[model samples]
Target chain A: MDEVSRKTFLLFGDSLTQRSFDEGGWGGRLASAYQRKADVIARGYSGYNTRWAAYTLEKIFTKGHVPPDLVTIFFGANDAALPDRLNGRQHVPIEEYVAHLRAFVEHIRSVGTKHIILITPPPVDETVRVQENQQKVGGEQEAAMLPERTNAVAGEYAKAVKQLGEELGIPVVDLWSNIQMQPLWQACLSDGLHFTSTGNAAVYHLVQAKINEALPHLRPDALSMDFPGHADIDASSPDSAFKGTAIS
Target chain B: MDEVSRKTFLLFGDSLTQRSFDEGGWGGRLASAYQRKADVIARGYSGYNTRWAAYTLEKIFTKGHVPPDLVTIFFGANDAALPDRLNGRQHVPIEEYVAHLRAFVEHIRSVGTKHIILITPPPVDETVRVQENQQKVGGEQEAAMLPERTNAVAGEYAKAVKQLGEELGIPVVDLWSNIQMQPLWQACLSDGLHFTSTGNAAVYHLVQAKINEALPHLRPDALSMDFPGHADIDASSPDSAFKGTAIS
Candidate 1:
């Protein structure tokens, strides 16, 4: 056995990504899946869109920091805000969203990160969003003027993300289209924007699959475990048992 | 709103703690509970006991690294292995275990972290451990000499941890005693030495309560959220809305 070292998978995004560590959330699933294989670091910034994220990205990926083995860039839920909406401060023009995303990829590359996977935002359920907002604001009259986001707008951002992934040769998880194919797509989102447990599971499955394909050698089973089996430890020098050796 | 600054909750332990990022695991629950508040860093070293962990602790807490705001040190499952067992390489003498715990707490404090929480290992269920080991080793005869751990041994370690915590004036989660108090406590351990999802949930509830009591200001709701509500964003200068302000 050889000394064991750890790699990191960085998950960067907005509220959806921030919530990915919830019970049975995708980030937790990935963390478990990569146990002993890699460190899954969640750098989720809730309510963030591409415009705001662009400012934070440079700060997050500076020269002194270690580069993650893989970085999953998931955004756009807030960026796809409906243009006409008054509180649509989260929105980013589609073109600007694309540019920011590209800049993000370049920045990651500059930091020496080797793998970058882009995840498109999941589709929104307008009916659910409307009803949820109506209850929050007390009536449909006020809700009508404050439709912060629409599925149609989110769809456009998702398309742009997929196109950017292709343009950059990075793998992309097309969550926007893939999630809707589930049996009860509407149940995936608890508040029309954020994910429920079921939605998180869907994202986990897709991301796991993409990882298996893109970085097969770094899969969970492929990494050297940090410690040896109980049967193999040398009792006299317990610490020495794992010092020069890594579990197969 | 002011710029949001997050704290950190460090989970330090063995395999049991390592698996806490699994779906419905305690670490994931904590992460969700602390969303926008803190980063829950899981530093679980599988198959490690107090002796081995003590060696690694110094390396992890060196100066210049960002100090964790809160640290939860949960070990002992592997440390409590029956002395007579052949592969009980994980065992640490009760007195030695107590010393290691103190050293860990001291090291954490030396590095500038202010809060430290200690969690005793959950009790083992011998019947399940035997059955699981029997299936792996082919028969009861082979498993007889390899009773990896016992509830009685774990109980002792738990006592030491509690006593150490009391002397140090640190908050303690007496998991060994509290978990067995649950109905069908046997269901809490998947094998004998590790936690099932049920056990993880039980631990999560206990740790959450202890954190609330010990560090109320660091609780989930007390920390600033990453961004303001969508409705509050000033569209013209959306970035300015969250620039100087932290979501409270």
Candidate 2:
């Protein structure tokens, strides 16, 4: 962290966060927006639930060595899985889900992270999901995957996340509620779980708005641009030209 | 450096590298491809030539602190600008360009960078460049921007880079020649100078191939994946789940 000497935005979450650098994904957009302002590091674990996240937290982020300025934890997608499902490997009950999230937040705050954000799982489109799920897993078992995850169940997790944010006094991005409010919310998800380019754009805009509201100083306009404008560069002493202005 | 404990691929270059995280850009693609294996960090100075890049080397890559495992030096687009052009701000003569590149490679080697790759500037399409330049800068002076950059001129720098790679015993990605060899290479560039999604994909594939050839061990398949599989976890003591397999 001292080596780069720039503010860090650490994103820790599940597959959505893992694929955050997809074509026009939210993470890449954030990276672009924070170009010279800060460094955005994504520590996403696909197919991971809150339990695994809590177990792996200490392994990924230690105290004081490289503390992130802003940390966002997004999970519950896999945790919200139905308990009766064959792939109960990733399912966590609502109570444990809330407890794990609370522990994760407390641990991050204990590490001296000043700003923390908790993003709820987006609403799942079960019809599209079942179709993709069948094609993915294949055979008769695919049709039985009907309610492996439903928007209604995911809504409960979203509500819990919102309540947790209030309890912790941290900012929360209500992706589930806000996304569904959009007229073309269905278009946001590529396969009822992952985000399409449109979905990424929607998240980017929402996240950008939140950053502006909660941490205005981290905004693009607030941070210094890279290398000073080309015209301002002093040809003779190129080093001094960007001395104070550079992102050292 | 020890904080993350993961390998780092540091991209050192001009605007092309700066915009490497753009939608479907190469850097983000590389980062995704190398997820859990290594990190791809961008140290791009937009609108900068090799001269300025040389001046800022020490400031960006200090000795013994967060030394990169693989360093990529990408420039020559700005440097290849015609000497007598209006945009002389970015032009570095062929001789100085080669010398600066050599110095950069040597400096990186001195800092213990295990792998070094020199990426030649992709060829400039003069016809498309003139059109974009006219729209961007505008007015009668636009026409005089005639040879601000030319494929033939950029080819010289690419040749010099390849030659330097031979002298320095490093791999070189001959982007200028290989890209044009593709059908409808003009579609590769978004605005004559920068790459479109197609161009980024082309460069990424070529660079991936080069990495496989030069540093096969760094390939995604070669490096170990992050965390152990979830099914193997000991539910009682989760810490033992990743005893020897974690990203420590």
Candidate 3:
């Protein structure tokens, strides 16, 4: 086997987008949810900035793997990383970040990918662990669950994704708000950098919603026989994951 | 835009298996490789182990992302991680790694990825920084990179895949040695952890070979030049990329 010829979808971004929910990352779940005679390829890395992302992208296509249909991108987490991942506490200006993203998007499009989902990374938890061993940034060392500080970056990044989407006409999925909304997000992280087993599950649902958001018709609503939750004939109702809001 | 109802290929594995060559990871390149005809859904996360891989398959399927024609898997790098990633410093034994990979292979086959490629990870540079960062006890770390060390593990893993292939009779691509022989392998990885921009390109090519291996008839060798890479040539001088190989 010397040639890889699958119709690939390249996922370009930072740790949030890159980290595997092997037991559970959002990408994994999305892969599961969407795995049906389709090929979804993930090409994201953790703790990276847009600069690296841009440079990395070039190496990919120029070397022979070119022309992707969909490229789902979620960067800026590490680009907004605490000083260590960043350049001595210097944050990447939002504008510069956008430029890099645009270049990536443009290149992807140029290579023939018209459909793309530019995602925003879930936020950061500046105060996730305040002990001396777990400290990053200018914030006072205090015990704060990651959801506190990280989601801000997620928010800003998501907003930027939407803006990038608008400018480039690609779809955008804001995982920052979605991930933050989950009470279990903090508990599911592998380290401060990656997701724990459960975190991937949560990320999965969020990404599903985003993909579904991009192609709603594809997910024909699953009909519950006997209206499961309803007190009806033959009541064998496993908890309905779907919260039924009656379609008007 | 409410759902991503597209053809998918669930890619599950570590960095080399996941990293993009230049503009996109193999996943992205894979999407392009197929001309966006298949919606490749990725389940790639960095630093995951066989246990984690096995645990998640059920969750993914139960959630209903299974059932694909292809499930290209290349793991064990993280499983072989010197410091280990699952529990952080919890090194995975070769036996344990083999078991999970076997399970992973079974499940993917069970889910009907008739075209499954059990790829062994590329050799690690014991001299690299990240590998050095994770220098550990026993020759395990050094072994994963070596043909003999991890080769036993690789053999066990590959044998399992082969046995499974013989049992289930699926083809397995021996990426371990082939990748090692490639001229540019070491140049492609940044840290010992994952594939670098250039390294991934070689991977994409290797994967391309796997696909060709599976569907040899699709190769230019099988048929005259009537595919994508074909160009308007005098027929005297054929496609250069295929020069000396097939189209003469």
Best TM-score goes to which candidate? 2
Of the native A-B interface contacts, what share survives in model 2? 0.19
Cα lDDT computed for each candidate against the true fold:
0.79, 0.82, 0.52
Q: Evaluated against the true chain A, what TM-score does chain A of model 3 have?
A: 0.69
Q: Candidate 1, which segments miss by more than 4 Å at Cα? A: A1-4, A85-87, A138-150, A227-232, A244-248, B1-4, B142-148, B226-232, B242-248
Tens-digit lDDT string for candidate 3 (B1-248): 11122334557765454343223356545554543134444555444456444434554433233465567777766565444222233245667776676677666656555667677766655556434444543445643343222333434554444555556555666656666677866676576446664665666677778778776643324433111221222223333432322200
Task: Kindly list the per-residue Cα lDDT of model 1 for residues A74-106, writing each as its tens digit.
Answer: 999888877666336677889988988898899
Q: Return whichever of 1 and 2 wins on lDDT.
A: 2
- Candidate 2 chain B, run of 10 with poorest lDDT: B239-248
Clashing pairs in 2: none
Better of 1 and 2 by DockQ: 2
The DockQ leader among the candidates is 2
What global local distance difference test value does model 2 have? Answer: 0.82
Please give, for every candidate in the order listed, the TM-score of chain B alone compared with the true chain B. 0.92, 0.93, 0.67
Say which prediction, candidate 1 or candidate 3, comes out ahead on TM-score: 1
Q: What is the lDDT of residue B229 in candidate 3?
A: 25
A1-248, model 2: which lDDT tens digit per residue?
12444678888999998889877889888887777556677888888888877757776768755578888899999999887664566788999999988988887877878888889999998988787767777747844568578899999999999999999998899999999999989999998889999999988888888888987887778777655656778766676785642221
- Local error of candidate 1 at B86, Å? 6.6
TM-score of each: 0.88, 0.94, 0.43
